[model samples]
Target: MKPKDIVLDFYKSDVLLDKKTVSELLHPEVTIDWNSSEGFIQMDYEDMMSLTDQMARAYIRSKIRISHILQEDNLVSLRFSHFVKTIENPREDMLLGNFFVIWEIKDEKLFKGFQMSHFS
Candidate 1:
């Protein structure tokens, strides 16, 4: 897949809760630097897998709605919002945040990322 397509598929996937998908899309040495409303966080592949497990326990389902996407070579940038249905209230989807992220695809997987987000 093209870099843009890989990143798009990653976001369109159930990445928050599915470890198998995450493993498939993320490189073994993947690393992400994220700035969110909560604070800054740096995560590696294992951290990402752990986060997926945690989200699985906390949310019933989740989705990403992309507003914009741009690609330059192996770099793909996207703007989107995340919505989730909590385990406690599975019937309603709550807006989790709005995000802007740039991903670098290497070895046909998400190798590196820089992301920023704020609460919606």
Candidate 2:
């Protein structure tokens, strides 16, 4: 898959439900630097997997709405919004956040990322 395709699929796929999907998408040495409404956090591959596990336990379903995506070389820039149905409120899908991220692909997996997001 193209670098952009890999990045898009990573977000669009059921990653929280399937650890194998995350394992396929993130490189072993992957790192992401994220700045959110709360604060800045840096995460490695294991951290990312842990996050997915947490989200899986908290949310019943989730979706990503991509607004824009651009790619150059191994770098991909994407803008999207996340919506989720929580386990406690499975009937309603709530807006989780809006995000803008730039990802670097290495060995056909997501190698590094710089992300910024705001909650709704």
lDDT of 2 at 6: 94
TM-score of each: 0.95, 0.95
- Give the whole-model CA lDDT for all candidates, comma-separated: 0.92, 0.91
Q: After TM-score superposition, what is the CA distance of residue 78 in candidate 1 from its true location, in Å?
A: 0.5
Lowest-scoring 10 consecutive residues by lDDT in candidate 2? 11-20
- Residue-wise lDDT of candidate 1 within 1-120, one digit each (tens)? 899989987887467688898899999999999999899999999999999999888998889999999999999999999999997898998998999999999999999999999997
Candidate 2 residue-wise lDDT, 55-115, digit = tens: 8888889889899999999999999989999888889989999999999999999999999
Candidate 1: deviation at residue 53, Å?
0.4
Off by over 4 Å in 2: none
The true-versus-predicted C-alpha distance at residue 14 of model 2, in Å, is: 2.4
